[model samples]
Target: MKSFFSNQFINKTSLILLSLFSFSLTSCLDKEGEAPEPTPVAYVTLYHGAPDAPEFDILVDNQRLNSQPFKYNNYSDYLRFSTGSRKFKFTPVNAANSYVDTTLTFKENKLYSVFAVNRLQDMEVLVVSDTVMTPAAGKAGMRIIHLSPDAPAVDVATTGTTGTSITTNLNFKEHTLFKDVATGNQTIQIKRTGTNEVLLTLSDVALTAGKSYSLLLRGFQTPPTGNTNILSGQVVTNY
Candidate 1:
């Protein structure tokens, strides 16, 4: 009978230990499952705003984007990358030195535009956060970026019946807020601030509904080389 009681005590202790071990394992698994996931990636689009800068390749964190070099006023589609401090290197094709080597930290769940601006010898990157929300029906969002280093402040007005000033006094390297406007092929003009002299006239440019766009005024008023009238404009779809 003593041996039987001893066996029973041993069995009960073993069962208790087994239950405790199982509970502990399950608790550990539950904790692991409840842990948060890593942060999501951010999106970035690149634009070459340096009029005199040569075609160059982009390397993000030492990874080359493509073999083809990006040229003046050229833009890239939004690309996905992780949120953190990132190194962007623009190496000129057939050249000994890099055009721009800059580092910037980015936030998650956001869109950005990185501009390679200024002269080739004094190149820099200008980062702009973009809004990609869909606009209301029959309306599109438009914004302006003035990257022409030597140009004066300007205003944008729509041509035709809607010939009204949309933005005013946008200085060099400045940008305007995105505003809603009627959609479809529209003619627009850029003029000097407080003056009637038109600098550029863009006609039949398609502005689709539920989208956002950025009109970038790049190049220089008096270019160092090449064409004397170097001021130019390009459009980018932000959404």
Candidate 2:
């Protein structure tokens, strides 16, 4: 009877050892099968600057990126994108064909701006680097992008005619590097380059200290009657 109890105790110990070994093997397999996390992402902001074009869905490498359609003068906040060479497509809402198909390279830890410019008949995507360093105390970084397809080259004045133009002769599809501006209610004037004639005025735009901004000129100088897309000035914040 003592020998029989000794055999039962040994069998129970062996079963427990086998169960633990099996659990250890399963854990090893699970760790080996797990996928590595994705890396090297960039931030991008998309804009639909094409006048007379319908709302569009932004795609990357055949995958839809935007949650909804974007129209003229509409833009998005910074969104995460995988870094590398990427094919960007701008397709109309509920349509399969793309109007602007282009490939752009994005580096990791950088910011980018993608714009759909020109009229629909000759539309294309233009990519701009948006990387910026934080400005010094009490200063804000500012820049201008010329997106008006039909408008001529223009000068941007942060202060009416008294001070130098913020930028000059900035034509279609062109953008200037960021310049520092004092934060306050700034009176912006868009004038014909080298001339005092003003084309548009953005009254008392408030620029906050320690921030960055892009002043964009978009739409047409002469828009179609009743069309909301007109020659305009906009300040986009880059935080």
Candidate 3:
């Protein structure tokens, strides 16, 4: 009877240990099958005009990314992105002679930059992207530049689904630049400072996520003639 009791106790202990081992193994297997979070990618792009135009210096978030001119035209000049947000500034060797500087923004998985020159009296910047469109966010990422031989006052206004206006006075022969715009559809209205007379108005503008745009406004006001303005091409996106 003593031997049988000992044997029974040993069997129960062995069964309990086996069950514990099985449970641990199952738990480890479940953990192995669990999905992991995806890693974020930085999407960086450069948007500049003059595809046929000469290549110039490029600075990303104040860091020199490219010193030489890009090899392709407008479409090919844009850079591909990977991940992270970046601030970019492109200045041509002869900015005064060149049409304009390259303006763009770098955001996670999305980056766009565009460069163009001023031909007419007006200049414009068009923001385009494939990401979602949020007006407030889009406008926060945009920037604009105004150059004039004679420093003339400038004013900015948004005319679209939302009408927002801003005005500023520019010094003579001064170049004005505005930055940090939100994402969405809007317009920029430029007028001479101290005067209600409209100097230039950019309409049907689209601001997109992960993208950047630049505009060059040249020419100053003359006795009767107002300031010369330039308008950017349309910014199209799936959003």
Per lDDT, the best of the predicted structures is 2
Per-residue C-alpha lDDT of model 3 across residues 1-239, encoded as one tens digit per residue: 00111344434533432343445556665466665343333333343433223455554444444434542222323344323333444455434233333445445566343433322233233344433333344354433444443436676666656565443675432332334455566677777687888777777577666554444444433422442222222232322
Ranking by lDDT: 2, 1, 3
Cα lDDT over the full model 3:
0.43
The count of residue-pair clashes in candidate 1 stands at 0
Error of 3 at 210 (Å): 4.6
Write candidate 2's Cα lDDT for 105-218 as tens digits.
988889999889998989998889986868779878889999988899999877854343679999999999888776788888899998999999998899899998989899
Report the lDDT tens digits of candidate 1 across residue range 119-232: 878888889888766667888888899888888999997788756567999997788778887778888899999999998888887999888888889888888856443887
Model 3 clashing-pair count: 43
Which of candidates 2 and 3 reaches a greater TM-score? 2
Q: Better model by TM-score, 1 or 2?
A: 2
lDDT score for residue 97 of model 3: 35
Comparison by lDDT, 1 against 3, better one: 1
Relative to the true structure, candidate 3 reaches a TM of 0.35
Error of 3 at 117 (Å): 10
